[model samples]
Target chain A: DTAVSQTPKYLVTQMGNDKSIKCEQNLGHDTMYWYKQDSKKFLKIMFSYNNKELIINETVPNRFSPKSPDKAHLNLHINSLELGDSAVYFCASSQDRQSEQFFGPGTRLTVL
Target chain B: AQSVAQPEDQVNVAEGNPLTVKCTYSVSGNPYLFWYVQYPNRGLQFLLKYITGDNLVKGSYGFEAEFNKSQTSFHLKKPSALVSDSALYFCAVRARYNDYKLSFGAGTTVTVRA
Candidate 1:
């Protein structure tokens, strides 16, 4: 069974549209994170949540927001998507602050 | 600021031969080190981690890493390579303290030829 899973492996839409990526973890983790992998293969953290409470918010744009209804789910919603927003988004979960994170298959977002 | 470095852009090895992907880290105080692998069209998979334990740590899929305190390095190594093991590897590091977000390396591509 997949420990962490994300919905819609691939997303395609036009610029100025709104999109959301859903994530779920069955590993009973208290912390969840969102990472963006650019075309150059560099991964950067955008946000992190612990037990449905937002923790880390790097200098992400205001268009990007994350909501965790419960500990097991953290979803990312991006409004007014632009061409620069196109990238692979990954969701990860960890048992706690210092544990190794389990990642879900990435969602490739494409904006035209 | 904590950071990780994967010096090699790519590492090539033949099947049945040993392989190594180098990784170095910089962090204040104690550090939590991690190694992850990623295949094409997939997310990064947890390989192993070093958190206040022995210098050498082992993880899934026949992989292990050595954490050298003096050198500030955590390198992943395997005794034998397989073609199926070819993928992108990333090294990450975090401070031992709380709310220590992980910092990842640029990544190294490993190509194992059969």
Candidate 2:
């Protein structure tokens, strides 16, 4: 069974277009996070939610918004996407504030 | 700020031989360290972690890591390397009392030759 899964494994879009990526976790974790992996393979945390509440917003662009309707789901919505946004986005979840995180398969977003 | 460093860009080892991927960390207070592996076009898989326990912590796929407080390092090691074990390894660290976010290293590519 997949512990954490992401929908639309591959996303290709044009500049100025809005897009969204969905992530779900079956691990029953309370904390979920969104990370972006650049072409250089550097992973950076963008947002984190605990119990459906925003906890950490790592200075991401205002155009990037993360919504957690429930603890098991965290969706990322990007408004007016830019070419620089082309990268693999990963979703992760942990049991609590301090624990190992399980990651999703990742969504490859391509902004043409 | 907390950070992790993976000195080697890549580590190559022959099958049936022991392998090691070096990882060092920097943090203020107590730290929570972790090791994760990633295959091509996949997500990171949890390997092991060091919260506060024996120096040697073991995890899935016969993987183990040694936590050396004096060195501020948690290196991943395996007794016998397999070709299938080759992947990208990442080291992450987070302050024990800080937020839930983890700071990851640059990642080291492991290639096991058969």
Candidate 3:
């Protein structure tokens, strides 16, 4: 079974489209995070939520929003997708802030 | 600002040879360091971490790291290398307190040849 899982592993859409990536963790973690990995393989943190509360918001665009229905689930929704948004997005979780992070298989989004 | 530096973009080694991937960090307070490995087309897997109490920390897949406070380094080391050990390795650092967000390096790619 997948410890940390994300849906729609491969997403292809047109510009100006809206899409959402859903993530869930079965490891009983209280902290969750979103990271974006570009084609260059540069991974950067986007946002973080602890127990469904937003704790960290990096220099991400406003078009991107993170919602945590509960601790196990943290979903990312992007509005007005652009070609620049084409990249693999990863979902990760940890038991605490400084603990080791468990990452899910990334969702590769392609905007045409 | 917290930052991690993996100075080498890529490291090459032969099978059965010793390998080392260097990492250094900077933070306001004492740092918590970690290393993760990513194979092709897969998400990163946690390799090891150094929170406290140990200068040399060991983790999965026969990998270990030495935390050097004086040098601000946490270098990943393996006694003998295998072809499968070749992967993209990331070094991350964060504050010691809770709710700490990690700052990761650019990553070092290891290539093992026969």
Top candidate, metric lDDT: 2
Question: What is model 1's native contact fraction?
Answer: 0.80
Local accuracy of candidate 3 as per-residue lDDT tens digits, A37-88: 9988889999999989899999999999999999999999999999999999
Clash pairs for candidate 2:
none
Model 1: per-residue Cα lDDT over B32-109, one tens digit each: 999999999989989999997789999988999999999999999999989999999999999876464999999999
- Which of candidates 1 and 2 is the stronger one according to lDDT? 2
How far out, in Å, is residue B95 in model 3? 1.3
Report, to 2 decimal places, the DockQ of model 1.
0.83
lDDT of 1 by residue, A1-112 (tens): 8999998899999999999999999999999999999998999999999888888999999999999999999999999999999999999999988788999999999999
Clash pairs detected, candidate 3: none
- Residues B1-114, model 2: lDDT tens digits: 899999999999999999999999999988999999999999999999999969999998999999998999999999999999999999999998787979999999999999
Best by DockQ: 2
Off by over 4 Å in 1: none
Better of 2 and 3 by DockQ: 2
Summing lDDT over every window of 10 consecutive residues in candidate 3 chain A, give the lowest-scoring window.
A92-101
- Residue B99's C-alpha lDDT in candidate 3? 52
Off by over 4 Å in 2: none
